[model samples]
Every structure is written in C-alpha cells, then in structure tokens.
Target: MPEFAEEAEVTADAKRAVRVAVLARRRASTADQRATAAARVQAELVALVRRLRPRLVAAYVPVGTEPGGPDLPGVLAGALPAGARLLLPVLRDDLDLDWGAWTGPENLVAAGRGMREPAGPRLGMTAVAGAELVVVPAVAVDRRGLRLGRGGGSYDRALVRVPADTLTVVPLHDGELVDRLPAAPHDRAVRAVVTPTDGLRTLNGKPGVVPHTSAGRTGGQ
Candidate 1:
C-alpha cells in the first residue's frame, strides 16, 4: 500500500513539473504568436465541425494564453450548423464541471479560476453525453492521447460523462503535443488533438473512438 501511494505521489510530481514548464512556455508567447495559433486552431476545429456535423457540441472558452484563443467560442458558433447548440462548461464548487449553453460572446461572463463561462442556465453534467463532439482543454497531450490538465480534475470528471464513441479533442500550441505524459487512475485520455501546425491527428487508428480504459501505467499499459 505504501508503494502504491509513493507511486501516485511520483506521478503527481511529474505532472506538476510538466504543467509548470508548459505554462511558462505559454506565458512567454507574444501576442502575434498567440493570434496565429488561434487562427490555425480555429480553422482546424471548424473543419472538424464541418466533417462531423454534430447537432450538439461541448466546448469551453479559453482563458489567458490558453490554446484556442479568446475568440474560440465565437469561431465555433459560426462554424456549427444552424440550430445546433454549443455547450460550455461551468465550474462547480466541488471543481466538477456543469454545462451551459453558449448563446454568444455577450452572454459569457467572467467566472472563477480565470475562466469565462456562459451566463445561461446550468445544464447537468450529463449534457456532455449528448454531444456528438467534445472539445476540451489540455496543458499538453501525448501521442497516446494522455492529457495533462491544470490539476483541477474538473475536465477529468466531466469527461467520464462523455460516451466512449463521442469524438473528444484538445487544441494545443505547436509543440504541446509530445511523446508521452504522466497519468493517474482517474485521468481521462482523449481520442485526438488539434495543433496550430498539425491541425488534427487522431491517436486511435479509428477517429473519434475513445477507449474507456484509464491511461495510467497500471491501466493503459
């Protein structure tokens, strides 16, 4: 039992180190670079929406220096087919995520944790299960689709509500996609990643198919 606890601690430390490094890199990015990455990421996501034609999409508004840029919600709204709805995450007190509808930029209000969330009525966590496509945020993702988040576990909890077959993706800056990342038992792995330079790359051979198995060493390996 002690050995298992120590192993978990080591994994947490590794993830923290990676998070610090990645956030530093993001902080150093100039406005122009962020703009360019934003454009590219938006383009890729737009393309994905077009291809999937999802009647409902679950996504979030990116905060400062986060990938997908501040304009992402608007960009996605423009790309989605008419009458289709966009759901943005609302952070709950327990750090779990509740969903809300993205009506427009004006409807988005400043939220806790440096986030911008929809001001509309709250949708239960299970709303994500109804989305045909889910776009999440990641500090980084490995080729195996193991995601490194900000350690809040908000998205991790929300992701479990997503159907295994629903298309889940993350948008990243050019080099944020790496060979591997540390994972814990509750961590969720995504099916694909979208980067400024690479556009979209599916980790699973088949696109949009997320393996229900956890990505930690004891599980995925």
Candidate 2:
C-alpha cells in the first residue's frame, strides 16, 4: 500500500505539471482560440450537470480572466434546473467560504479576489456539512482521485467538514484528468469526477456509481 501511494503521488505531480503547461499555452494563444475552447468546455460542463442533476451542489465562481472555459455562472445557468437552487462559495475575510444560494446571475455580487458570489443569506458550516453534492474546482486532477488545488487549502478545509456520504466531484477539462496526483494524508479524495468529455464516474479511491436524479434539486439529491 505504501509503495502504491508513493507511485500515485509521483504520477499525480507529473500530471499536474503537464496540465499547467497545457493551460499556460492555451492562455497564451490567440483570443479566438481561447474563446472557442471556452465555449466547448462550457457546453461540456452543462451537459454533465444536466445529466447528474445533483441536489445541493456547492460550486465556485471564477476569478480573473484566465480563459480556461466558461465561468461557473454560465455552467450554473445552463445546467441547473429552473427551480434548482445553486450554491456558490462566498470567500470570507478569514479565507473560508460561506455557502449561499444563487437565484440568478443578478443575485451575485463581487466578493473576495473579485469572484462573484450569491448575495443570499450566509449558510453556516452546518449547511455546508449537509450538502448532497459538492462540485470542486481544481488546477488539475488525476484518475486516482488526487486533485491539485490553488494551494489555498480552503477547499480542502471545507471538504473535510462535509458529510462523508456527500458526493464530492471535481470538474475539469478533458486533458486535465490524468493517471495520478500527489496525495497528502490530509488531502481528501472526491467520490467522482466530471470532465468535458466524461459526464461522471466514480473515482479510484471510491466505489459504485453516484446516483443521478433531479429529485434532490434543492439540497440533498
């Protein structure tokens, strides 16, 4: 097991490095290329969300204009059902995010790091703990369920607070998913992954397929 873990870590690091290089090149390309890729990625995210239809999903809003793909707002608008209440992470002063419901794009306000957030009432830690599904952002991820985050550890901290039964997923571009990722003891593995091509599936560290139904559209689907 220790050997396997070590190998997984090395593989994860290599995967992250490759993805970083790819994204850097993508960002440096012509404006038209970036726009076209963003559109494609956005369409993929929408399809995945529609198929999964998670209840009580926790997702993040994008900051800056790096041009990775469509931002979270577009993904939410395209994928979420009309009555489905989408949750956005509101970055607090202390570097923690307060989960809030997004009624629409107009409900968002500029928050920490210039990320857009829901203006709804702040849901306490308990509300976050009770979520049915959590959609995480990643710099990159591997087939082994290891994710490379933005180094803030905010998502890691918040993830630890969520119930074990909640389906944790990381959505990334197709090329971002690779064979492995460096894992730490404190790092948490998501239950599944959603990519531009792949809709959803169980991750390496977990078992069974995550059920997809629109029933828990409010909080616990």
Candidate 3:
C-alpha cells in the first residue's frame, strides 16, 4: 500500500518528539527521577485498565528499545482482573506476530530481537480478531487517531485481522499525544489514547472524551 504523505509527516514529527523524551528519561541524573516517572506512568496505566475493565485485553510486554518502561509488566500484574485473560504478542520470522495468553510474569521468556514473549500456547491470529481491546505501543499518535509505530509495521499487519470495533489504543507519555501524525494506508487508527497522567481519552472526536461503547469485534479488511 502507498503511504499517506500527511501521515508520514505526522509520524516523523512524533518520532522526533518521542526520541527526545526517551533521551531525557534516560539522562535523569537521580534514581528518584526515574522511579518517579515509572510510578506516575504506572498509575496512569492502572487507571486506564480500570476504565477498560471487563474487556478482553491484548497488551504488550516492553522490549529494550520500546518507549514505555518496565511499568507495563507491573501494571498488567496488578490491574488486570482475575477472570480476564491477558494476551501478549509473539513475533514470527516474518515480523508478524501471533497472540498468546500470559499466565504471569514467569510465563514470559526471551525471544528473538530481545523481546519478552509469553510461553503460553500459540492462540493464532484469529485470537486477536476476537479481542475486545488491544493496547498498542506507538512512537506517537495524532489527534485524528493516526498512530506512528516503530518502523517494523508488525502491529499494522497483525491489526488487519482485528475486529473494526475493537477498542484499539496506544499508550504514551503525556507529551507523546500530539496534534497530528504521519499516516499510511496500512497504518491503523486506534479508538483511544492512554497516557501516564491522562487515563484514557477517546480520540475519534474530542481529545478528552471517553468512548462509551464496548470495543467492537469486526475483523480487519
């Protein structure tokens, strides 16, 4: 698919912003600063989880170069309901990912490209098609719901099979939410945004509006 020129510009700017933020985060002189940011981000993630309750959640385990810190594991550990089945992505040789269940932190093992993946049985791409919510990691997101992902385009391919109404979301630090993003035809638009301090914001319309419908389950085109 041809890339969207406007989307590309939005993505480039978003990447620049996130790269700067990551650098600043890495340069914090004191342990306290790093700890504080982690705690704040965790709190925001917990709030987002609460607001998205009862939905089958598909979230990622952070990798070395990913923007979100180690907070994701801890947030998933504490926030997910007992009855809720947590799903994680498993990258294949082709750079596409398949879904699997995460029993707990121990269920994750080191995978190719230095990523941590669930040890659970492969649940196939169709599993993603069934999810009610999918929390994706992005380099940046614009007001129109365009998300700039890491260059691999793995999520874009994986998401093509997901139900259209699924409450797809991308979580970033506060400033990662921007006015616009670079979009491509293959790039998917998420329904919401979750930030370290903002909880969850519906992005299909107003910035702060919370979406009321249960995440939709229509498979990707």
Candidate 4:
C-alpha cells in the first residue's frame, strides 16, 4: 500500500479502538451516573450560552448513553436569549447533517440511528456556518481538540461549513477527555470541550470555570 493509504488505515484502526473503549464505558454507566453527567453538562452549556449570547446556536439531542442526556435540546432552548434560535441537526441519507429550528423536545420526531430530530423544514448543510456556537457529539476528544466521532463523518462534513471564528465544542463523559487520539488530514479540530466533571476546557487556553446553574433544571423535567 502507498504511504498515504497506510496512514489512513492506521488512523482508522486507532479511531475504531478508541470508539469501542469509550462506548463500552458509557454503556457501563448507571442511570444515576448518566443523569448526574447530564446535569453537569447542562450547567456548563448554560453558562456558555449566557456568556456568549450567540444569536444562533447549533446543538444535537443526546441519544442513548451520549453525554448530555435526552433532554439536552430543551436545556439549550431554555438557556438561549430571547429571540435567539437553537438549531438541531437533521441527518440526511448520506450522513450529512442539515439544520432545523428546535421548537422544543415535544416537537422532536424519531429519526434514523435511534436519534430524535426536530420536525421542521430543512435549512441545508451550510446552515451551520451561521451559528456562532456549534456543539457536536463525540465518542471522545483529545487534549488537542480532535474529536473521535461514531464513524459516520456527519459532523466532520457539517463542520467544514463553520466559519474559522466560530466556537465549536464537544460534550463528553468525564473520562472521555484523553491525552490524544488519531487525527486524519480531513478531521477538524474543535476549539473547546465540556465534560461532566471538568466543566469547560479550551484546548489552546486555560480551563474555564463555569458556575453551576439552577437553570439547568428548567427543561430537565
């Protein structure tokens, strides 16, 4: 195989290994643990939205054992400034993410991959570019901010449209933040990460302390 092909194979193998390990740990977590993790993530996200006050924010609903929990969309909806809109992803047939307005959790419909998505008009793939803050899902993220996604490449493709100045973040379970992960040439580096135990940490800067919010409770019910 060519050197480039060999490198791609190695990176793919590394990503698979990390994804399996991280997902196993997530599945082993108890219900109580998942709930606690969700609350912490909600707190950090609320603080971020309040501080940034982005006119348009993009986020996803947490499915299965993913870090932010099932009600994450609603939590973000409650946190946004009045008139600011929250955009949720609509997974296309080719695994590309299209954007849609998040009315509330009640408006979400079942979609492919056991995910819940907003039942609204599609805003096209480039819609993500308009978001000042974009929060993506990750099986794991490294200290350098390279995210190991679930192998779908959906967010990877969606991220390409994000402007250079936009803040892209990934939410993770406490242990999912690691020293390193394999990075391919096409992989995008996110600016920051939020974890259940660690609050928020910017890869290229000092860790930020986000105050815990009672606001995390707003749409949690």
Give TM per candidate: 0.92, 0.72, 0.75, 0.92
lDDT by residue (1-221, candidate 4, tens digit) is 99999999999998999899889999999999999989889888888798778899999999999988899888887988999999999989999999899998778999998878999999988998999889999998887778999999998899889986688888888888888899998888887888776667777443442323343421110
Give candidate 3's error at residue 111 in angstroms. 1.6
Q: Candidate 2's residue-wise lDDT over 116-146, tens digit each?
A: 8889899875567766567787767777777
Model 1 / residue 154 / CA error / Å: 0.4
Rank the models by lDDT, top first: 1, 4, 3, 2
lDDT of 1 by residue, 1-221 (tens): 69999999999999999999999999999999999999888887887787667899999999899999998988998988989999999999899999999988989998889889999899898998999989999999998778999999999899998987778989999899889899898888898887876677777455435333121111121
The number of the candidate with the highest lDDT is 1
What are the root-mean-square deviations of the candidates from the true structure over C-alphas?
5.9, 6.2, 6.2, 4.4
lDDT of 4 at 183: 90
- Model 2 residue 27 lDDT score: 59
Ranking by TM-score: 1, 4, 3, 2
Residue 6 miss distance in model 4 (angstroms): 1.6
Query: Please, what is the whole-model Cα lDDT of each candidate in the order they appear?
Result: 0.85, 0.65, 0.68, 0.84
lDDT of 4 at 103: 91
lDDT for residue 70 in candidate 1, whole number 0-100: 91
